[model samples]
Target: MTSPPLSDLTVVKRAGRIAAVQASVALALVLLVVGGVVFAVYLRAQNRQIGAELRTLAMTADDANDPPPDMELALRENNGHISTSDGGEPGVPLLTGATGFSDIHANGREYRTLVVDRPEGRVVAMTDLAPYHAGRNRLLMALGFAELAGILASIAVVVLLSRRSVRPLANALALQRRFVADASHELRAPLTVLHTRAQMLAHRVGTADVRTLQKDADALVADTRALGDIVDDLLASATMAARKQARDRVDLSAVAMSVRDSMASYAHSIGVTVNLECESADGTAGFDVIGSAAALRRALTALVDNALGHVHHGGTVELRVRRDGAKVTATVADDGVGIDPDAMATLFTRFSHGAEHTTREGREPYGIGLALVREIADAHGGDIAVASKPGEGATFTLTLPAAPPA
Candidate 1:
């Protein structure tokens, strides 16, 4: 059996955590290897220095009564007599006849001993290993603390770096999911319009005149072409990078009119009326804005579609466009069951619903269309706003930069 598919958020989070752990482990291993090398070198040097000191004392000492600091000397005569230095401790292990370097442990302490044979007698030189052992212990303790600190630091650094490195991937995944959802929502309205037109064409085929048949066929073709355009636009958006696409002058009034026309059949089918009103600061017919025409149309279509979904039968949905200063504003207003004040905060959030309404034809709002509209408006260097009350109507206004005059 196949495993259930993971969400984009889950995949991104898991990937980031895995990357952090792998990086932390890698850094920890490096620290361990370095520390091990340093520790090994320290032990080797300490042992070598101790051996040299023992050899020196054994070969050059003349009297057992005087020995180097922290060292003990023992002399054995041919007659088997034994003696120790004045300051020597009692527990130094002395090899009677052995004549080489060796280690001796006695009285819970360690000693490095060197026995040398001389002309008159035998000499034994010894040094306590306690201080050297203490030094080694100190070094080990320091290394242990350093390793702990290094591991902790590595974990922190790796987590921070991994989050920074994976942030772009996370954003891309989020955008991909949003794109798919937006595409699906964008296609729904046109598909519905096409389906409605097809049904009408089929019903009129039996008794309709040739001219009427031609009109229905034309309408179906136009809807299909519009659907194709939406698909192409979505595909282009997916493949292209942001802020790099070519933009041209788009008339907000024209977009509003087109949205009203496209949604007319669907709205009529649901017993709702769609209207368009345009005004300009200079009393011009068109309000020009610089952006992608297809995107602007999609944005307006989403607004109208959302309005149609919420409004009851016989309700009026209006598309109003006007120019103010350097901005062109288009508003979609509907006399439907207005949105609740509490739901306004999340109205543009994907997959969020608004106030309860008795939808026409069982077409409940899926809550993706308005979110896409907001994104489109943002992409065009514009913003959207809404005003609504519980019992009154709702108005969504999209404002975009006006195109400079030719």
Candidate 2:
């Protein structure tokens, strides 16, 4: 079976959660309403039966001298003596009251009683309700257990069905990731050859007597390098998107220095100054983080390149590394025109340029740089933060968990 795209994983899981909650709540409500109705009907029928038994006992005692088989009877004389069916006077108190039906407690047992005035004295008939009540209690207890079992069984089925339903989606995601990996690898070869040819052409123009073509050659070199950066970015993004890359202890300080050195020529061409700094003297200890070194280096390069685009000629862009406890940060700060407040929200989103399509350098911001940086940071279990105000320049900080002490 083909796997679902990775992008759908979040949607599938969210939909499952919402569906599970709604189904469980609805099931509980249905069980409560149905159980309540059933219990009410049973209670009403039981009450009617009890009332009928009481009436039968009353009718039997009103005619004959003895009580019915299921009833306890008491006959009182004019003076004080009372005769009872159980040969005990425990039910004598039941006859003292006036006529009509009532509940009585006698000899530690519950009874439904009726009293009628006779020619000689009063007659009281009572039917024990203890057995009926005991049966009802048992029935209610059983129903309660059954409801609990039903809820548990429903939850089990919900979980099983949900997993089965999302299985196809999960499979699609695996296939999509594999395709991205394959495509990136296939494209890398041609891009590398083109980049190398561009380098050679630019180098040949260094000794040629073509003074007028020098500007065009430089521009060609710059465009070719930009294309190479884009290719590397695409590959990095695709590979890191899967979050399956092998990781090792990466020194943010070293990554920063490498980015700074690689961009030195580009910064010179743009007439912008770039600086790299680290917290420690030798920068060997706390700058370490568990991540892919190449991905981190590319992320830092993107930041510096983005800053270079905003800053004017002679403006300074600073790349700094510092560690605090178990966390390390690499921040890129530029003294260029700061990011607009309105643009900050979508700054890292792909193809989300704020003001215009192109930066001050007249080059179109691919909008992929910051987006790729954010992706790489997240893949390494890190995060990116931005602080900027109009005209005050911008600062982008990438924070990661420091590697455990060796």
TM-score of each: 0.58, 0.50
The residue-by-residue lDDT of candidate 1 on 1-406, one tens digit each, is: 9999998788888989998999899999999999999999999999899889988888788768868777898887778777888645442345354678787776676788888888777888888888998998999999999999999999999999888888988888887877687767767887888899999999999899999999999878867865775565455445434555348988888888888898899789889999898888878635989888888897888788778877888899989999988999999999988898889989988657774665444333556667777778878899999998765678999999999986
Candidate 2 per-residue C-alpha lDDT over 1-406 given as tens digits, one digit per residue, 9 for 90 to 100: 9997655668777787778777777887788788888888989999888778766665556433556555777877677667777632556766766787888776787777778776777777777888889888988998898888887888778867877787777777776766566555545655675566666666777575676457556666666666666667666666666667658988889889989999998788778889988895345566889988988998998899889888867889999999877789999999878898888889998656655321345344556789888998888889999998877788999999989987
Error of 1 at 221 (Å): 2.0
Give the Cα lDDT of each candidate: 0.81, 0.77
RMSD of each: 7.5, 12.8
Which prediction has the highest lDDT against the true structure? 1
The best candidate by TM-score is 1
After the best TM-score superposition of candidate 2, give how far the Cα of residue 251 lies from its true spot, in angstroms: 1.7
- In model 1, pairs of residues that clash are none
In candidate 2, position 190 carries an lDDT of 51
User: Which stretches in model 2 have alpha-carbon errors above 4 Å?
Assistant: 1-218, 280-285, 356-360
Model 2 residue 339 CA deviation (Å) reads 1.0
